[model samples]
Target: MAKRDYYEVLGLGKDASADDIKKSYRKLARQYHPDVNKEADAESKFKEVKEAYDVLSDDGKRSTYDRFGHVDPNQGMGGGGGAQDFGGFGDIFDMFFGGGGGRRDPNAPQRGNDLQYTMTVEFKEAVFGKETEITIPRTETCDTCHGNGAKPGTKPESCSVCKGSGQQEVVQNTPFGRMVNRRACTNCSGTGRVIKEKCGTCHGAGKVKRQRKINIRIPAGVDDGAQIRMSGEGEGGLRGGPAGDLYIVIRVKSHEFFEREGDDIYCEVPLTFVQATLGDEIEIPTLTEKVKLKVPAGTQTGTYFRLKGKGVPKLRGYGQGDQHVKVTIVTPTNLTDEQKELLRQFGGLSSDTSNEQEHHESIFERMKKAFRGE
Candidate 1:
């Protein structure tokens, strides 16, 4: 494929200044950097941006390119200034910020990877809290080698290729000029150490996979999707680094009778027609125990009543939330002939123009409008 014009790649005209080229390159590099952009083509676009910047950032290369226009690599264009090839994203950052982009020491402490465990809790257990134990598989530093990845009484040797720096430098004479690049050493795989004798237990990996039993406490009133973090309880760190955290993600099992919304508990209580019309004291089940709830006379269906301090405990505060009970009047079924006749007689006692009938009709109309969001 033909190479794109350097000015076009940087989204600039031929008359663009050096400062404009640098600003456009920085913006494009940051936009297409693989670390920041996860698009599949971002890496290739980043390389294109870097290549464009490499030619335009220097005056000699820009002048040569302007004269030759994508000079063939086989017949190099003469240049007075050189450009350094960046190794990775770190190099770009080091160029923007003042740093040398030196190689890191592989023996330095690196924090362990964090682990997550999803736990399903019963509705009551989540509302009232409970302590439980779970077994999870994770990586732990080797006991025999003490996280060094070497056999007992033995040690790792410094990588001869990188001389313990974990990186190797390469110099190349490009069409532009001399270019230097730093890359991880292949001999030691960037670890800066070679293990002559591997540990038999962990197989020179410095860590072992094991099933560990962890005791966890689910706090009271923790709703579904709540997370409990346990510090230093994740996979063991490398080179004596501090362990990562263990996140316990709570998934609350649904209750058969109750539903929770934030700190409040909601439940639907069925009421017989007689009990709704003529008040009665009923036993209502709560998180702790059964409590007496009085149904007022002439209570309408879908009526909501609040039971103070009968809901789930507050996860962050002192008092508990109130439980909201919605009363639903259940029409009696399979009525005997005499019972049906009694209901008919009861209905006939209330005249069409009676004030009590009009009041009930008005209440039902208001409820209908409320349900319709009027």
Candidate 2:
């Protein structure tokens, strides 16, 4: 079968940018990789995508392909070339597997892996901030050999098989074409050095695991999912490289009454029905202290009041956020007989005075009118 246009195969147009071509190839490669996608034709589709990317990603190859539109590489398109001139598949594999495409010195410094610790803090503590210490187990450079993996008095020798390059090239003639790839040397296990006398403390690994104590100061107003980075606090590096960083991920526990959004705080306050009808001053709890809040006369349930500077401190800026207080009226229950009679009289008086107080509408009267459809 005639192969589809390279652009069409990757679901891209002819005018697609180099970045667009790479992104599309990566997406399709993951989608059709034989190990990941078990469909019958996935392998073929993956090869097709790979071929398109190999041609389009290189400027010289792309220009020739654009001009000639698929000339036999063996016939030499105005130049002596064949499948041997195609881009190396090692680069494609490296995109996913993190293998080095070119030669590299094994003794080069390599940074250590970063570490993350999830810290659960109390809600108030997150708002107020705290300083504490923690213990973590991590790898550190061996003190005896000083990261050389050899005894104090001895040193390592270069690998004879790979000649200290740490990698070996392999040429394979497959159905697709001739391909050259690099793999770790078997003699020295890619370290490029052989240790005759290993370090007693680290056992030739050049690193040892140990429990480390670290001090951490969590800033005020840190919310859930916030991360604090501590430099040079991660696992020890390899070959005298700098250590990686440590990240503390914060998780804030929910407060019993208060809730936070951004830097602002929200809470519900309960008010008696009588207090809602007749205004009263009540103490409300804040992050710092209790403050007096005046409930206006004839206040309704679910009414919100703002208390300035009573919420969490701004994490990045100077000022604090306001706290929103929502009042909910609570009804009285299990009244005494005398109190019940007084309530009944009060309802009657309210109905009688409805005309005098034009704004006041008795609950019973409203219900009666609703039932009568008046």
Candidate 3:
């Protein structure tokens, strides 16, 4: 069969730079590397890409290929050229393809798994930051053999299955020709190392389970379900990898008198009839301190008053939110004889105060406007 053009295979022009050739080869190889891309033609495409990079990467081969206009060794079978023949091209293909064998250390230490701890904070604490401690069940590096999973003074040995490569190369004879697949060695569990003298404390496992107490500073304005990550505070890694991260999932307990919406705080302030009609200055409890709220005369129920800069602070910015206080008028339930007589006299003077017909008309107008989507 005729061979494809080396330059066309890599999607590069004849004048492409060395760096350009390398970058394109890396992308194409990683994409169609066979073990990564399991398509039937992935092996052939990978081979084509490797062949292109082999010739274009070398200065002398690139000159020869340009002058002779040939990339296939079988096409121009002569070895009349002096020094640079096909001697170094195999190494170029090996580097471009990242080789067919996995050589990563299976026994190499890796980062520990990420851990999560759910903590419940009071509503006030969530609004105003607090420092607290939590106990978590996690794993840490074993004391005996120092995470090698071996007995004291004894270290793990290289795995014989993959010859300490941590990867086993399996060759498959398929219709597409011989395909090589590298996988983690089953005997070593991909660590490329095996321990014969197991640690008595951790029982061959690199980690030991225990309860740990961690102190964390919960920042203000952190809402419920917010996660705070603590670096290098998770389980210890196998062999000797870096520790993973610890995530704190916050659960803020709901306050009886206050409710939060985003950064704003909301609460209902109850007012008596005398306070609402005659007006009064009342002290309301905020997140930090109590502030005086003045109710004007004729202040109706459901009236909202905003206390600026009293709500929760912004988690990511500078300004704070406002606290919205809504008033709810309370009616007197019990009345004495003298009070009943005074109320009757007051009702006689304020006869037009109970204008039900006009209130009905206002409600009907609102309903009509709502139906019209006004």
Candidate 4:
């Protein structure tokens, strides 16, 4: 079987850019992967397209491919022959797949991982805001070694395996020709250095486990599951890298009387039957203190009253939210005999069918219709 043109295999024009070639190859690879597509000959077709893309996607190899169709006369380009001697494929793999063994720069500092800590705050603390201290276990730079991982009088030495390159090259036989790839050196694990004498405290790990105390200032109106970030307070990085961030996740404890919804607070206020029949001023609980609430005369059960600016303050803006008090008129649960006789006399004086200035007719009419299946 003869080889197909690289452009034709990837379904692209001869003038297609390297990025275009990569995009085409990624789509085809996903569509024809052996794990995804179990059809016969799918693997072979995928390999053929991959090889074509691998060559034409690189600038040097594409130059050679343009000169000789599917065969680079200068560098042996034919299948099973001399076409696969190009070394630029490593760059292509690194660019496209982020693989093919690139080493981390030993001189460069890396950022550490972010850590999360759950904190419990009282309802009042969440509403009014408070500053509290919390302790977290994290990795810190070794005080004894100063993050060098070296002993008292000795220092780390360059790796002998990779000769300070931090990478090892390996040659493999491919369908086109022999290919060389770079991999991370196993001996030094790509650091390009080895610790000769271990630090006694850190044990040559360069970091020590320690508990960190961090103080966080929680803002007002913070609800449950709120997150606050403390920068550079997490685990210390390796090789003298920068420290990570610490995130405090807030969990507001349940309040005894109030429930929060956004900035508003809701609570059920109990009222006596006489207070509901006649107007009265009642004391209700607020996040800060008790406040007087007005109950209108003839107020029905489940009546809601709002007190402006009595709720939590807005976290990001000005002004406060209102508090909603739901009134529940309670009937006398346990009545004494004298109390019952007084109630019976009061009932005798009041007419059974009396409307009482039509104030109580609405509730009675609604109940009558409801019982009649209206």
Candidate 3 lDDT, 275-316, residue by residue in tens:
887899999999889999999997866778999999998988
- Give the least accurate 10-residue stretch of model 1, judged by summed lDDT: 73-82
Descending-lDDT candidate ranking: 2, 1, 3, 4
How would you encode candidate 4's per-residue C-alpha lDDT over 1-374 as one tens digit per residue? Answer: 88888788899998898789899999999888654675888889899889998778766567656864553334433465444444344443443356544334764666778899999999989999998888889989888887878897888888999887777777777764555666677988877788989999999888899988888899988889877878899888776788998878889999878999999999997788689878899999888888988888988777789999999999989999999998876667689999989877766655555577554444446435544556
Error of 2 at 280 (Å): 0.6
Which is better, 1 or 3, measured by lDDT? 1
Stretches off by above 4 angstroms in model 1 are: 1-86, 89-103, 356-374
Native-vs-model 2 lDDT?
0.82
Residue lDDT tens for model 2, 170-227: 6767555555556688889988988999999999999999999999999999999887
Which 10-residue window of candidate 2 scores lowest in summed lDDT?
74-83
**Which of the numbered candidates is closest to the native, going by highest TM-score?**
1
User: What TM-score do all the candidates reach, one by one?
Assistant: 0.72, 0.70, 0.64, 0.67
Root-mean-square deviation per candidate: 10.2, 10.6, 12.6, 12.1
Clashing pairs in 4: 76-82, 76-83, 77-83
Off by over 4 Å in 2: 1-88, 91-101, 169-181, 352-374
Rank list by TM-score: 1, 2, 4, 3
- Of the two candidates 2 and 4, the one with more favorable TM-score, higher being better, is 2
- Clashes per candidate, residues 3 or more apart or on different chains: 0, 0, 3, 3
